[model samples]
Target: MKKLNCLIGAIIKDQNWAVIPFGNTILEPDDQVIIVTIPENASKIREMLEGGPVRTNHIMEE
Candidate 1:
């Protein structure tokens, strides 16, 4: 998530309380990770999370 300029604020597993995450934090398959970033970089951020670029169709009207 670093490549996307996103920060992992915390991680929550099961119903336990959230814990502050760090660079070396190990994310589990079911762990819920919270990230913080700006809105301008949302697309790129989402792409990073989704593992690839998301294709969008730009419709033109005449």
Candidate 2:
């Protein structure tokens, strides 16, 4: 199994536009998120979050 460390945050949508809150934010309806996840489970995580891929430069060593 792989471990992913992600900063789970949220975003809001309004009038065909989207916004992401900053600092000590709370989740709201239509809020999106920015998260970091492992490459293997990235796709599934994205689907769950209703978002897209997270950019990563590090890989896990076994």
Give the best candidate by TM-score.
1
Please give the TM-score that candidate 1 achieves against the real structure.
Answer: 0.42
Count of backbone collisions in candidate 1: 0
TM-score of each candidate structure, all chains considered together: 0.42, 0.30
Question: Residue by residue across 1-58, what tens digits does model 2's lDDT show?
Answer: 1222343333324534333333334444434344444566566544444432333223
Model 2 misplaced stretches (Cα beyond 4 Å):
1-27, 50-62
Q: State the lDDT of candidate 1 residue by residue for 1-62, as single tens digits.
A: 22333444555566675854544444444545565545655555456556433221221222
**Backbone clash count for every predicted candidate, in the order shown:** 0, 2
Error of 1 at 5 (Å): 8.0
